[model samples]
Target chain A: MDVLLVEDDYYLADDTRRVLAAAGANVAGPYARVAESLSRVAQGRVDCGVLDINLGEGPSFIMARALKQRDVPFVFATGYGREVLPDDFNEVELLEKPVDPRLLIDAVARACRKHETSEV
Target chain B: MATLAGAMNGPGADRLSALPWEQTPLGPRAGWPGSLRAAIDLMLGAGAPCALFIGPQLVQMHNLAFDALYRDGSAATRALGRSLKRDDPDSSLAKAAGEVFAGRSILLASQGWTIGASPGTPAFNLSCAPIRDESGQVGAMLVLAFPVTSPARLDAGASISELQHRVRNLLAVVRSLVARSAESSDTVEDLAAHLDGRIAAVARVQGVLLRNPHAGVDLEGMIRDELLTQSADQDRLNLGGPEIVLPPKAADLMTLAIHELATNATKFGALSQASGKLDITWKLDQAGARGQQLELVWMELGVAIASQAPRRQGFGTNLLKRRLPYELSGEADIEFRPGGVVCRIAFPLAPVAAMGSSSVWGVTTTAGDDA
Candidate 1:
């Protein structure tokens, strides 16, 4: 599955993007702003995405809603911790910041497999 | 007493005896303008209550009650009509004056009047001294009464110190914010914008500090540094100007305002395009005491601004209109001429001396040779 990584912090975004690509899934981007990333998702270029809650504004909930309408599953990745998770995302998988590269690979694989089964 | 009579008859002795109070009744009991002899005789009859001498020349005192009132300097007080005004004047005079003025064997109690041998303790309350002359006449007395508690004197120093500390903390916060924001930006354009905005924010806080007439900031060099640092390719940029201290808020806004122009140039204007160069210059003008103005110019070359948004106002527009006016209390004009974008920002120079500081002003020129 191809994943879209969205974060405003450039260094962390670049590092996470490299590690995610190394985990075998094709990675499209780690867009700085939510609006730019949502545009990409609307164009059908992404199968799943990892979202940071704060991309300048309070949270990336708007982009998450856009993905939901397209039936695309995504994971939350943030340095601000699980509390930053939106109230509506009680059931979504969240990967806390400072995450190990190996753990991230497993999480992505698990999320992709779950999406495939849910589709089934 | 025989010597006293001889001195009274001597030359200049009458001058010493006649004081301002001698022209008036020493007390209502004697009716009006009584003779110095009668006043002194009456005072002596009443145990020489409290005597005061109001005259241009030195005072003379011979009363035991007056001498005992002063823990020191009774003879000096007698010589100088006015008590010296320094060195714990309050406590000294308060202890001495209370006994002499009240005609009692108690410690004087003047709460505020300052009286000493020097520029005495300020905010004095009361003063009293025994008056005597060669004739041994004690006429109308001198009493200095004042109120000495000043509210401003109480809190001014502490408030000033607290304000300075807070301003320093704010600058530190601003530096951290700039560092963090710089970390967030991707290209040189984004980094410059972030840094410029952060610098402006700090300047705003400093402006507030400076407007207090307690703190001021250097405007010219600050603007140059913030702008040059914002350039993506720092080595390519050149800077020039003599630094001038500005009113604190002006420093904050002026730097940020000028920096916004530079940021735009690096992203879309002259600095962003290939072969683009930037020259920053400033000068200090003494139009009026209050109209000291700082002039800055951002000149660009070799960058084809036409490739960017030639007309649309994006980040640059917001920075000039919204941030500049709000932060710097100044006006900025940005023009995209045929060759490059030139920006000019001008505003009044606040007096830094009032804040106990000296800020230098001069011209500095820097050019960015970005090949």
Candidate 2:
């Protein structure tokens, strides 16, 4: 599985990538900012994405939307609950931290499945 | 005038009894239901600020703490038996009453709650809870005003939701700290000691931030505290610069960075040797549109550079070189010179007053701390 991760915090981004890599998943750019992720999403070939809601600059909805335009599924890895999300993102799955590694892996699988099932 | 005369007849309870309860939607006091009666008793007898909203129509009664809110008795008496939302559609009192009647308990920062007989309406910290009736149904809601002064109202932009986000983010940061600290240490003992020191650094920042939120964290005080914790000799170390209040967001990481520098100095630099000395100086400069910039220089003397240089990948090294610039949108440079390690860090300052502390008007928040 190919998963893109976006988080501004250095330790969190690094730690999350380690967890995903250990689970045998190929992690894409764990980009620290939305602008950094935008170009990567433009490069295509993404299966799913995991996003932190609030970046240093603002919310990561821009990255979330970029992934959506590619028909890619994504989950929000956030400190906040669903209320923090915009109304348009009701369908996105939310896993509050510190998320269980198994839960994160399962959430990623479910998000990836959303991509495959929508194809039919 | 007559309303004031009526309200002044006696205490809050007596004034409440003086009301013609028979004409109200809640009906005569003699025939009032147990739940309504219980809530009324609670509000009347309570020593703290409280308001009771009975039934769906939102009839109201309050305690002495809220006496200022009803000081204008004409509005107070006329508001009885009427939906609080009737006139004040946007008020927190109305919103709390509306939500409570709908069966959801909530906390609201009341911008309208008057403190004492104070001239202006200062903000209040209010909590709304459902009061159950004899039938186990939400019959009334008790709205209690916590004695929070408008100044300490961290809720200005920092609503409860924002606080939750910060608190949760803090937890995540702590979790990541534990994992990363373990990665750096060679022994379990090293991990324990390093992790404890890191957490202590984080806690020291949090403690100052919490106590004097109005007065932003003092940079000199923060530096001194870190060095003091390490038991560094004060006379050899020189701290200079004007009093700078670190923007709350920058305080934590800055504290950690300073902790790292102090630890390094204690182990290999100034604090370690009799001949060593450290000079930490800072200057505040205008950075145009980005506001003020704090330029700090940490220069240690009398220590060998090459042999004392810590591992390049240490947590302190990464934080200073990478995280500081990224998180604070600032600049940092650590150069190993013959004299010692010279580290320069500079960052733009954001205002801390935005976080809380309504002290701009020269008044501290009330002492009640009911929040």
Candidate 3:
């Protein structure tokens, strides 16, 4: 399983990477900036992605839009409440920050599983 | 002119004579018109803040009461002989003086005027009338000013509004802290201790913010304050970082995260032993596409093997690993090295101006680092 990770916080990204790796998913590009993450999304090889909404440069909505266009499944892992999420992304899954490791693993697994079902 | 000399010889006579009014637009008093001299006598003898703006230039001649109103003596002295038009272009006094010069008497009941940007700006009420010569032409503008009682209350409503907003946000943060702290604790004692520490961290940030309400809290200073509270001997800890001002929310979150790290080091990490050492260093990474990013590293050295794996997944671990990244839009890498724990964190440093006004909830993609 190939999972895309986009988070600017080094510690949280590494922690999420460890959890995903342990779940047997190959984490790709925990890209810290929006531009780099968008470039990785353009490659189209990611099975799933976990994104932080605010990337310091700005929000990751552009990257989310690109993923949505490609039919790739992703979840928002952020500290902000759901009210802060864009109205357009109302259907997407959101895991608030200080995420439980188990919850993160389930979100990624579910995203990857959903992607597989949609492709099949 | 003799009567004008008599007025000057009265109370505050020496101080009035000491002023170099001879070089002013009015010139020597001996050459003054009779109408102007009589007006000066009336103004000098009055027990109120009064001033005479003479001629079309509106050259200023004020009484001692007016000088005491100025907090800065140099500012008061600097105003002497200068035209009111040049001294305060947009002030009510200037505007009223203009109207009085045009032969219209204006009585302002309670117009407000702030002296400066100092914490407490003194406010005043002013009134003015045109002083005419014996020939009936308006020769000068006579102005009277009185200090407003309880001027602080004049601006209290606005301050109270902002204060209410801040207090609400702080309460929300505290609620979140309490909930999160409870989730990671194993026992009641653990929860109590953890909640106390987290609340203290929030309070510390609040203290710094209150001291300098306009400027944000300093990053290095916050970390040092948190670390010092945990460790008795400062020699065991080494901290190095450039000065960075964090927005209120960022400062609060960072203080909690630092507190967590220091607590871990004290209980089951490097600081658990006397020989243990801790080094924390940070630097700005400016080559990012969006804006400057801050990369901070925390490395613990000389920890006993027993302290390496103390509860693998706890509140401290979750906070460092998840909360920081989610809240700050930063990255974190926590590794249990052979010697001790090594945590590296990276987050974008939003320009200071954007931190307070910009909706912490609003997401935008603007790339300019205006700081």
Using TM-score, give the best candidate's number: 2
lDDT (10s digit) by residue, model 3, range B190-213: 999989988898799889877765
Off by over 4 Å in 1: A1-120, B1-215, B231-235, B285-290, B310-319, B322-329, B350-371
Q: What is candidate 2's lDDT per residue for A1-120, written digit by digit as tens? A: 788998777777877899899998899878775666778888868788999877642343777777777778999998777876778789989988776788998999898888688898
Q: Rank all candidate structures by their TM-score, best first, as comma-separated numbers.
A: 2, 3, 1
**Model 3, span A10-109: residue lDDT tens:** 5557667887899888998777766677788776678788987755433337777778888888998875556555687887788876667799888877
Local distance difference test, each candidate: 0.53, 0.75, 0.72
Residue-wise C-alpha lDDT for candidate 1, range A15-91, written one tens digit per residue: 67888877777887767665567678877767788876554323347777777778777887764445545577776
TM-score of chain A of each: 0.89, 0.93, 0.89
Q: Candidate 3, DockQ to 2 decimals?
A: 0.04
Q: Is the docking of candidate 2 incorrect, acceptable, medium or high quality?
A: incorrect
CAPRI grade, predicted model 3: incorrect
What TM-score, computed on C-alpha atoms, does each candidate reach?
0.34, 0.63, 0.48
Instruction: Report per-candidate DockQ.
Output: 0.01, 0.16, 0.04
State in Å the error of residue B369, model 1.
51
* Residue A55 accuracy (lDDT) in model 1: 47
True contacts kept of each: 0.00, 0.31, 0.00
